[model samples]
Target chain A: MKYAATDLDHFSESTLHTIPLIEAKHLNLSFGKQQVLENVSLNIHPKEIVTLIGPNGAGKSTLLKILLGLLTPDSGKVVRKRHLNVGFMPQKIQIDPTLPMTVERFLQLGLKIQKRGFFRREYSTTNLEKYVDELNIGYLLKQPIQQVSGGEMQRILLARALLREPDLLVLDEPVQGVDLQGQTELYQYLNQLRHREGYGILMVSHDLHIVMKHTDEVLCLNRHMCCSGHPHSVSQSKEFQDLFGEHTEAIAVYEHHHDEATCDHSHGHNHIHLDETGESKHND
Target chain B: MIEMTQFLVFALLGGIGLALISAPLGVFMVWQRQSYFGATLAHSALLGISLGLLLQTDLTITVIVVSMVIAWGIFTLSHSKQLSSDTLLGILAHSSLALGLVLISLQNSVQIDIMGYLFGDILSITKTDLWLIAFTGVLILLFYWRHWRDLLNITLNPQLAQVEGTAVKTVQLQYILLLAFMIALSMKIVGILLITSLLIIPPAAARRISDTPEKMLLISMLIGLLSVLGGLFASYHFDLPPGASIVLAATAFFAILQLKKAPM
Candidate 1:
């Protein structure tokens, strides 16, 4: 299904080596008097996951929508690779109460593209069973989508998005309603998925603490690109500190702890307690 | 006496056909909460009616065109940042109805039954009207047969459907155009005032019992058909207005079904 790129000469050699999944340059969008997005430029390449982090009203959603071509930008350009397939998992889709849709039926709605002919033939993709098992939504498959919990719904949405076998996975605040533990598991699962499939993932997230662990890069935005780099660099940068304030200094960018077996080089664990006169209690 | 019987048969046939035509569209109206949109179309139909009478054109076709034009116009105008959809629908519904009444009052030559236009008269349904119902009924069935999945997907989520390459705008425009047609044609069956009820109630009732989308469609059609029949029978027996009788029958189904719990 890969079509040869005809405009390969237009890009630089570095870009020619591997085409980016999505490239947006200086995108600007506004609604009447309110400027929502300004001079936003970013790129998502395959086999990488980039996380978008911004405060409320920072136009993260607007930028994501623009990249997906749902909303028109005032002035800019977004070039998606030819025949690029995007599996979008929205924050939440409100289905009307009148429409009766079970989880299985909800997922089946995603199958319209693969369905052929008048008979439909019950089309099934190879990843359907695999993702269903991976996400552990087998029990929730038959239940009404409205009845499922928020965590379960996120997993189901992820499962449905995975079924598309997308070249790029676009998620908008995917773990909004899920609890703490569930969020960690979801991000872990996403990391595994990205590593296995080599799909480019562009996700919008609000949780700064947990997401930075698995995220390769974080683009901090506020109606424009403030700063963007790898987790450690972005977290330590003055732009991030100014935007988030001093409280962010304590936040670890990634899980600093590793199993003893994984890291053979062990540093000495020493703690000295300060008593009334001097450091009295010492442990090594 | 035979003429009276033939007229009654025409009325029954027309009622059944119109019910079948309007039922599926009604399901969408209920699901999308566009009952007021139906009412707006029905109200504006008075302008269509007045225009048809003044111009010596086919009333049904004139009404359909007029409603479609109005629907398109409203869609275009609502894009403006000035007014909200609720306000626009309200203004259009009342102003069009008022203007229509004024226009009809100016026409001195042809005698018009305003009550019949409002509440409907089953006995007055002509053979041509019956044929239009048959034509529209079959057309609706063909449309449902060809584009049911696309229409359902669009109704569920237009943006999602569009991303899936479902031709959302075309399906939506077609659905709205067909809805305008139904509102125009169903005028003779349930009259302008009761058209929305006929379009909404049976489907809402069907929603109570149905598990799947296909089942919902079937049950809606059946309920609508039964309402027409039961209404015709009650109108004949109790000498009530046929359209009102039909609506009451549908409401009875809603009430009766309300007693039975929705299945797990």
Candidate 2:
């Protein structure tokens, strides 16, 4: 098997890592007579981030619901590894103004509800603080969940998902309401988390630049899978352009470096390489 | 004196126990803004009454079965997405009440006490009714105690709950069934029209003072107990209907809480 070996490719050359952590086989879901998703199949491997992109009314939410087991597919099967755990960060959730919930309580609700038996013990608060600190959400812990800004809420939600220590992190619009700077930091943090924890991240996003730059695989869907593969390949495919329009073609790949300060310290001021068409390869 | 004490004790215990169990259920109702949903279920209790009279079986059990069926119907129909939940509940609530009235009117032989069902005569609560309320109360409290986190999670956002490995369908069905049972059992205490008030007002008022969900539930239970006590007292002294008095007392508590300066 001749594999494409390039310095630019970040995919580890490990043939043994073939089994996917999660698999959906030929999923078909319909609402009454109108079919939403048709014969869709997708897979997620350990330490891989796969992004699903589609236009409005294109069954994106339906597909996400199916994957989360919230909606049943008409004629398809989803297989997860035995005892496979998933942490899901949903799209923008609006809490009723009447039900006052602190961010700390909101995060705790996710961990506290994990039904545990005699064998498994729940995570303690002190242990969860580690994730809170890592996500830089410690400041908002005491604040009301409803009062937190959109970016802060996103981080809090991420922190809550991290508490589950899931095998796969499924995020639907993880940075929807955040600005450009916050979005980049979140994506960078996610990339580093995947590398460090060997997690399989599945995210649904409309940000072409971020998905093109960071994701290992991109699946373009318009009811059916139009085109899917490497982000570069998908963006170039005629089917993808047909579904997404030609404007996506000009989105230059934005790559970031940590500089001497490193993300370990507070300041993450970095440089971006606008690789037009991404034909240039990075060494080391 | 001892005989009087025993009678009063049973009534007091039944009312208070029902109030405690209602707290957990009520909190979810308020949080999810499903008071109307509860009202719809409560209204169908009148239908359950007619069905019970028609079946000539255990009235409480028949009521439970009918309410469960209606609750399940509302649940399943809402999933169809053809009609909004409010529209469905509106149709079901009023139509079921109207149907129940028609069914009762058809039975010329049965001189049904319709006012008793509409406005609850708690003084007539049987020993069997007391025991049923106590048993169901214990079951509900246990369900809420063990599944406290699950219930709250589902109420917070069911989609997130599903992702966290909660069996959303099973939990939801259990919740709906329990809600049906509550309405069926409490029909004797607060009647049909006022059942939702007990489920909503206490918790809604509790939100003003509570900073956490658990605290809210506890405070709601306390508030409900107070209302029951005050209502029973008023019924005894003023010869007022016990169900209406209880709901009125609850409304008073709500008004008082609103009047108090809430910590912003």
Candidate 3:
């Protein structure tokens, strides 16, 4: 159900033609003496994919949390289109071993019926199944949620996030444990999803090359807004180079190989070895 | 013969009521790794009892109040960054228990059996105690029925639960309050010291036999009921302490389930 946008906020009304789904301006935060984020400003518009790229300790997750309102920034304001629904995929939620939950039930937990104003919508079983089938995770539905393989786990989390039917998807390191093949497929799917649903996508990724191909814009952060622009321009910026080291040139090789589906010969070989070792390690 | 049967009936009903609520609470307590929190509440319960005796108030009511106050106190204190939660729990648990011992001993006007409070005197459960158990059991049932998913979500991840638009803080506060009430009412049947055991062991045993949350809850309740029955029976025939016997029976179930070959 859609409520009439009668009470639209000034931010939305002012930009009547193309209102941003969410906007954060001049965000500054600090924990005691150390500053985590400073003067970070970004806005997500409909059908846009913004990739937040930063090294460890760059406060990428913290920024995402501030955007999601999970944390309160010491200063700066976040504006959202009125009644915006955000589907947040956090980095690695550790489920306790004692809690026995199946993947189907884990997905079901994401089916929260949000009530904003007089409108309400029901996320049905069919919708859940549609996502499950779309992600090819139907096989894993009956298995214990904790026991799924890394690649399958990523798909399952993406499915859970999609179950919310969010206006904007905020994923923090969505492909942390996923293999190279899985990562490419996930980025492709996210791009396709954005085109189909027009949902704004804001995701944080540690890998610059794989994510840069799909990202409309990139924000390079390190305790501040180091650089922000199109992925090409951001990579060209000196600040981005200084922060990420001389790896800027290496992004070209990956970008060239990204289009060729048959270029994963080496990746496929290592993936098997990684999976075996990972499985053995997990058993312990 | 009638009097003996009457006492048995009261004990059984009270035990049944505690078992029903304890399963769900115990499952969550174990899932959240808050068994220590439950123990802390149980420890403070002795303080509640002493406070009741000194003030000439109903022991059950005073225990519930003191438990809630202590639960709230711990909840707030845990937010401070100085001391870890277990450290805080350890401090609160021992100090309140020592204070309770002091208060109980200082009061020369009242005659109280400390052993009964520690290990429980289930056979001596009064009709009033059974009513309190039933009332608390229904209240907890109604609560879980409404917020079962919410509790599960919270257990899985509090931040995710908050993002999903759950009233995480509110649900958590209510859960703490209900847990306080459960511990207070349970102190009489299982005694204050053994209350956490009742809220923990049945679920621990049930974990072996179940593969789903709902199944675990139901199985734990069944296990808890069985322990109560077996313990009461043992107490009658063998002249054992009922609370200790019940806890032992639960441990026995845990051990027995361990012998069941792990599912292939």
User: Highest lDDT: which candidate?
Assistant: 3
Quote the TM-score that chain A achieves in each candidate: 0.81, 0.82, 0.81
* Residue A57 error, candidate 2, Å: 1.7
Per model, the share of native interface contacts recovered reads: 0.28, 0.60, 0.62
User: Candidate 1: which docking quality band?
Assistant: acceptable
Clashes by residue pair, model 2: none
Taking the tens digit of each residue's C-alpha lDDT, what string does model 2 give over B1-264? 897677667767777877888888888888888889988888888898898888787788888889999999999998767898889999999999999999988888999888887777666666887778878887886776667677777877888887876777787888888998988888856587556777898998888888878788889999999998998889878988777888899999999899766442
Per-residue lDDT for B138-177 in model 1, tens only? 7787777767878777766776676666777677777788
**lDDT, model 1:** 0.77
The TM-score of chain B in candidate 1 is 0.93
> How does chain B score by TM in each prediction?
0.93, 0.93, 0.95
Q: Which regions of candidate 3 deviate over 4 angstroms?
A: A1-17, A114-123, A253-284, B79-83, B105-112, B261-264
Which 10 consecutive residues of model 1 chain A have the lowest summed lDDT? A265-274
Checking candidate 3 for backbone clashes, the offending pairs are none
The lDDT for every candidate, in the order shown, is: 0.77, 0.77, 0.79
Looking at model 2, give its docking quality level: medium
